[model samples]
Target: MDIAEVLTLADDLIFAKTGKHLDYVQDAILRGTLEDATYTQIAQELYSSPSHVRNVGSDLWKTLSKGLKKNITKNNFRAVLENSKIYNYQSAIVGENVTVGENVTVNHNFNVCPEKARSPKTPQNPEPTAKQPRIDLGDAPEISTFFDRKSELTTLENWILSRTRLITILGLSGIGKTALTLELIPQIQHEFDCIIWRSLRDAPPLASLQTDIIKFLSQQQETNPPNSPLSRGGEEIQPASPRRGEEIQPLSPPLSKGGLGGVIHHLRSQRCLIILDDVQTIFSSQQLAGNYKPGYENYGAFFKQIAESCHNSCIILISWEKPREIAALESHQKNCQTLQLNGLGESAREIFTEKGLSESEKWSELIDLYQGNPLWLNTVAAAIQDLFSGKVSEFLSYDSLVLGDLEYLLNKHFQRLSDSEKQVMSWLANQNKPVEISKKPALLELSPSEFLKAVESLRRRLLIEKVQKGDRTLFAVQRAIAEYLNS
Candidate 1:
């Protein structure tokens, strides 16, 4: 029988037996089984996760098996129904059915029929099957050598496995946001059925991104390849090759409905881990941090839905600054959280040692000067080795911290700040310790609202930090940022 006919008969049998109708996901699983589709294929079609589909299929078979009084599974479900004389039989027992309040029972004499009694029995102990996890890391940088994010990785893993839907990894550029995420994958890959990593380097339009992601989840190729581009910004960067023995299928045509709904459907259906790196690229560069660029405003809604919607998947955003929506959502939502990465502390020494810098009394001083940033320390370590024979004392003998390429990096961050934000940074640079908002009015000559706005802006940009002193909230710039501001 065709799929529709099978569904009709099965639905009737199921409802009669249990007084309940199969849900859409369950019906879809049944249809998929009739078509001989794999669980992954069924999940892709339903925009659900493969593991969820498998569970639904398993429950469906067990229900049918108990109801039909015969072993039924994905492999033999069609055969069992076909061989039961269900099409020609007119009665439940010899053709009679009994009904009770809101429930109907169909009795079939499977014990008398040798063919029905001798059907292949379902395996009680099924062999463990290796699952192939779909990984798509689009344009995420490769980490050649990673270090000292053990604690951070463990925290992130716990968050993901605990069903934290939205997580933001915030840090300065080259502070190992990408490295930490890359290192995090291997640790958490087993928990998820699919892992997707996309970079927002060129700031693609949110709609286009949604379409791309949905297509991937649906396991379909682009229908209008020449007419539609994968990414709206620069040339689309291809994802790396899948691990050996993993099959990487070609992109198929787009889904019928291409937008947030489709994406959410997949998320709800599957256990996926989606990583979006360089998320700051989608924000307006010259405006307040976290404000989306014109066309990308929809991203805020997308993220908000992913955080608020009931879904089993997790999305980790690696950004220089937290998105504005995230800042607001995380305040009220438990599943959404932000992790701000600070300097590597003693871990900075590893970068220096790897670069052949000798240990000295001034090593701690140097590390403190660079705020224990691995990239900053590595850059200065090479300079010290070249200019001072790798002597930490020689590097520390100078009254000022080494600027090197750090100035350029800081410039990129500074250039994105608004005038008010820059003003706050300038004021904080002159202070030795954190200052409270109450004290800013006299020094800045701005209104209370303006002052608070500027401080909030700086906080979002990650150019300043808030510390609690007594009952007051104080703000301070990091040493590296202060040094850059002074220079």
Candidate 2:
């Protein structure tokens, strides 16, 4: 029999014995074993960690061994299933009764012990009528003392509830993009059937991410396909498609037309909230802002499709810099929006209050100097308490801003700037106040187009701000950024 047939039969037999169907990961592991693929290979194809795949494989083998009443392992699973075809036929004939060993008998009636079904049970309560949504916040940083952002949270909720398919949270690092999303989860988790949180820090390939998400959404179905292994006994099984590497390939005509139809299908069928954190990791660091790294260009298409396509799901992309696709798609599409997160403003004073610093007039200037970034304020507040005996005025009397731990933080963001961006930033640093674009000095030796491009790049990178100056637009870097540039 073919591999699909074998997988179908295995699913039925395992369900018959264990009163549970194989999950997508378990099914993939079984198929991989039949195809002579290793855990690493399967994990790569599935966009899952290898250790997670191996754990699922181990549990599947153990369940099958108990169900078949024989030692079933990855090495011998195929042979064992092929040998049991006749027994499977006989078991179907017996109806609710099956012979396990020489004298052992097993019952297949699912209703007799309803509790033994595959569904999980609550500790003190009976089985829930509906499955609880799966929540996976992988490596998301915990926020202990989350200050303000109430209005932002409400805006996010309104967007998600309005069926907005794609939302991008744009901000500088340590500007609370992740914190805002974490805060939003509790308010919106009930709205989605499944809520997943994944970071693009390692920049997994787009295909792998699509496969992983599709698998998770597909597994929410209540029943398996009818053309299962046991039902297709002597039929031909088509070979699995060749694995795609990390490089981008031209999509087949069908896939190109569909634009990830499988993933969209699941999104249409289910309400899922997928939060992709650290999305800036996928962009090329040395290039202009919003440019994708090699082999990652497909991500732009993926995001565009998600934003434009009709689906019940919502995707929240949290990034240090906004992607170019977001700017294009969000402008024309009502269902897509971008939330640019600034610092905490007056609410940030709470950090100083919590740090036991005595409040004074200087507190406002200090907050302004750091742009109200909680991480930066916390570091500065600690410095003030330690070096100035918890006196804010004493610390502010110095001629310059304290660059203590803030230097390390600012250096990280500054190091990623393109040459043009650095030059523009340095020019802005020397300005006494916000300057209009038309009034920029000609000493920089840039044309109007080049100057505007650099300014736009800086805006995307969250390194500069644009403001209205009567009639012309004025741009200036934040105090912290200006300090970094001047230093």
Number of the top-ranking candidate, with TM-score as the measure = 1
- Evaluated at residue 340, the lDDT of candidate 2 is 94
What tens digits encode model 1's per-residue C-alpha lDDT throughout 345-400?
77677777777878655678888787777788888888999998888787777786
> What's the lDDT for residue 464 in model 1?
87
- What C-alpha root-mean-square deviation, in Å, does candidate 1 show against the real structure? 14.3
| Candidate 1 steric clashes | 12
lDDT, candidate 2, 250-334, per-residue tens = 1111222233776766565446788898999999876679999999999999899888876557999999898998888877556
Q: Name the lDDT value of residue 276 in candidate 2.
A: 90
